[model samples]
Target: MSFPEDPIACMRSLQAEFGDLAVLEEKGQRIAFVFSPELNRRVLTDPTNFHSRFFAVRGGRRSAQRRVTSGLLSVNGSEHRDARRIMMDVFAKKVLPQYHETIVGMTSDLMADWQTGQLHDLNEEMVTFMVRMTGALLFGITDGEYSEELGTRIDHWVRQNHRVGMGALVAAEEYTSQYEQLLQMADELEVSIQDMFRRHRQAGNSAQRPDVLSLMFRAQGTERELSDEKLVGHATLTFAAAHLTTAHTLSWTLFLLAQHPDVAARLQQELDSCTAAGVPDFAELQNCTYLDWVIKESMRVLPASSYSQRVAVAPVTLGPLNLPAGTPVIFSQFMTHHRGDTFADYARFLPQRWENAKPSAYEYLPFGAGSRMCIGASLAMVELRTILAVMLRKWHFQIESGATVDGRVIATMLGPTSSVPSRLIAADQIANTVPVHGSIHDLVELPSEARTAVVRRAA
Candidate 1:
């Protein structure tokens, strides 16, 4: 029923009308939209008949879209489970931790060169930084060859992808161009990743290969290898998902901080007390509690994908509603995250809500719920904390006057519109000096003395 062209507006309407469930009917096709946390749990947790319809596209030729759904994101069944198992080894707990150094290094390098006190397009800068980070860590692309070109294409692709479904005229011309460019960007990304895969496969020594690419080779050894086309498809999904999701989340975090200077001041206090004034060490990132809450709150207020879907292959009764077979069930993280009964002042930007609060299983799935929940969820935490900590340690920022932070939904992710703006001041330049301190979780914060003590103890 909500026909607003803007994604944010459309989502607001959907949240208002349907507390737990609302069916979106367009042209006589009813897609069941479920906002209740309990129902969302059942849909995500039960995968047997409620699997993703990877082939479904909006206003498209269905036949042409079959190829797109062949990757891990779209496919399900024993095969999907097996592939996920293989990926678990690569993106697993132990393996993901190793990238912390690389992540910290990448973040520091970017912030080191950032120019403060200027109106910069936050989305574009974030995409560049994210693409570079993914290239080096996730896909194993050599920096010299792909870094410059990847930045260019990612910016173009981000713009094109956002243009889709913006309005009638824009949708007509822009959607097609954007879809074509997205596929092209996929192709470009795959070619680069393919070279890395080929090298890792052929190399006799495992030590030389980066973790993810080597994991792909190992999966191949176990007869888990995807076909060349499927490999490219998987790589494309990883690139697009990893890059934009992180970029959008980080942008939103910054936007939130800019909007609430008091929150920003408190955050700086936490960061200064928790992390050293230089680059983040592993311990420092783990110790930044308030930073974690801020990121979680930001994700809650504006999740990357408002609605996640699954197609019902068999009839099932979900609470009060008995959905028929072939029903496409949708769940909104944005709606669920803002449910006032669960959260205080649901619309406000409040990180403290999570300080002593824990919602039920499906209530706040910034990352989707259940088994199909984002594989990158943990990795995202590390990266977000690392980048936010390092950036805050180095720079303090504010939004430009009279500018409002806005969002647009691109395929599977949310991002700022073309002209979103902000201003930055390097932390060293700021007059305020607040010592960062907090409780240590899995990560610890080490002072300079502690660093020396550890080194001395090791020696």
Candidate 2:
């Protein structure tokens, strides 16, 4: 069967064929697909039983960079716990505050030189910014000139992994070729990371490490200091997870806004009122209700990862099926987000749906649910909020007339259908090059203005 890897098509087919869940086996391979909210929760809440060896790659379990467990995302059981603890130090409340400047500075810079009336593809430029910003946040690599170089190395390795993963899904005989390419790219990236890490270590006296590298290095007291191999492992995973996710999330948000000019107008008014005096701090981000709604609706319609999978270690029951051991159980956010049974007219994108709308945690697993949920969910929220606030405050973007913006699913993430959105443009060519002021909510297009306050809740 020629299963198209295009995400939207694949998801629609799965939903129509299997309702919420189904089982598929081919060539002696067994896979189970789960779209039910309850099952999504069960798989995550109790990951140990289901386990996570499901991500093991063929050339070996080592990451694309060939590092061992460096961070929490790749490991399971006690090792994951320990890595999480160490990484949490930087992500802890204290460190996030430190990031406020970095976030604002990055966004401000992007919007500063934007010019109006020029046909610019903000998605591509924004992706570069997000990728660089993630590297800066996680590894303290802020130099834009160097950001591209570093991002290139990281991107190469990630794409290689994606190629291999897709090959495995289709049982392609060329899997070995893809795997070999993945290993080669990983080796190249490994060297680059090592050099960077060494420099950061040598500059320890400067107290200038702005990324997670310092945190991992200092995580020694939390049971163990990260080894070079392990440090690269975690860093590589962070690059992949944090970079593309942020970029895609931002692009999707723009895409949704472009479709709803009225919503964009309201959002702009809200930000305008909220920021009459100055930019909104992390605290004020919570009160941007309309902004929040836009993100929610966007994710519901086109989440970065529409489908996630797991393997059952023991026979278990899900809905009407008795899933056996080794079944590749799959869960889909695409279907769940659009299930008419749960969400009315789920196919349509409606930000208002989230206003005064509170669904069960299970019903909205855009970030996945339970223990194995996206570790950077909170961080993503903050990043998204910050970027959106800055981008909207400085300039407004709309899908260019006749611009074809489509989606193609590539493994765990989504990419635009055409290269137009990915093109890089000077920021000076965008409209509304006005400097924003006061709180973000004040500047937004809200029906009524509201004061900005810090949102301290952890995601």
Task: Using TM-score, give the best candidate's number.
Answer: 2
Off by over 4 Å in 1: 1-4, 54-68, 144-206, 209-211, 224-229, 428-459
TM-score of each: 0.80, 0.85
Give the lDDT of residue 102 in candidate 1.
81
lDDT of 2 at 353: 84
All candidates' lDDT scores? 0.65, 0.66
Runs off by more than 4 Å, candidate 2: 1-4, 61-70, 205-210, 419-459
Model 2, span 1-459: residue lDDT tens: 233245455555666887767655667665666677777787767777676643346355554444622445657788777777666666765566667778988888876666665566656776788877887787777677677788877777666665666567556667546776677777777788888787767667525555666767777445455666777777777777788777877887775565455677788777877655467787777688888888888788777776767777788777777877866666777767766778886766678888666777778877877766777777788889888887777665644433444466666675554533322222222222122112221112212111111121111
Clashing pairs in 1: 272-435, 272-436, 273-435, 273-436, 273-437, 274-436, 274-437, 283-444, 286-443, 395-427
Model 1 scores what on Cα lDDT?
0.65
lDDT of 1 by residue, 195-214 (tens): 65676456556555554655
